[model samples]
Target: MQLLRSLLADRDWSQDAVLLSRLQQALLLLRDPAASLDEATWLLVADETAHYLDFRRLRTLEAQLRGCTQDEVRYTRADWQAARTAEAALASHLRHVRFSSYAPEPVPMFRIH
Candidate 1:
């Protein structure tokens, strides 16, 4: 992460020209603005670019995360309900945990003379 950040920090991606071009294209494709794109370029976005991605995890959610949307990320009513429930559960758990069998032994206070 540090290395990648360092590399990208300068914003000089000339070292990896191909990756820079593809990333730029992907960003533009995502925007899909009013500007018209060439047919070949438009078709190219459909074909997966090398070193680019298709994240499967975003589509799949574990049983615990049942409230999340499947297709795209959007906060739903279920998500709010789940969040409130989790927050309440966490508070309850913390309260229970606070009442230990006995208080921990106290350490000597630092003396600064």
Candidate 2:
């Protein structure tokens, strides 16, 4: 909500693009049980970094919110829908953005002789 709005306002397109890319990778790792513990840990760290960035953005939003009256801060159903649509598009775009290290297909498990 407010946090998301703040992030959108404060962060440049490049930073958002980078963070979204990381988020996509993390989501992919989370979906795979076979991913290594180290991979999972790295993803968690990335998640925390993103959270910190979001927190900073939220703080800025809070300041803006404080300046406005209750009426000005009110949300409508259309606002909520717009936010959801934006979030979904960001997620989808991030997931599709290829990284040099990321494999297009999951690695298959093999039995060692």
Clashes of each: 0, 0
TM-scores for the candidates: 0.25, 0.29
Worst 10 residues of 2 by lDDT: 5-14
lDDT of 1: 0.45
Model 1 C-alpha lDDT per residue in residues 15-55, reported as the tens digit of each score: 35675465455455556676555676645543323111122
- Encode model 2's per-residue lDDT on 5-78: one tens digit a residue: 44344333224466656555555565678974376557654555565465444444544868964235544334
User: Which regions in candidate 1 have their CA more than 4 angstroms from the true location?
Assistant: 1-72, 101-113
CA-only RMSD, every prediction: 16.1, 20.2
lDDT (0 to 1) per candidate: 0.45, 0.53
After superposition, the stretches of candidate 2 with alpha carbons farther than 4 Å from their true spots are 1-14, 37-113
Question: Could you tell me how far off, in angstroms, the CA of residue 50 lies in candidate 1 after the best superposition?
Answer: 47
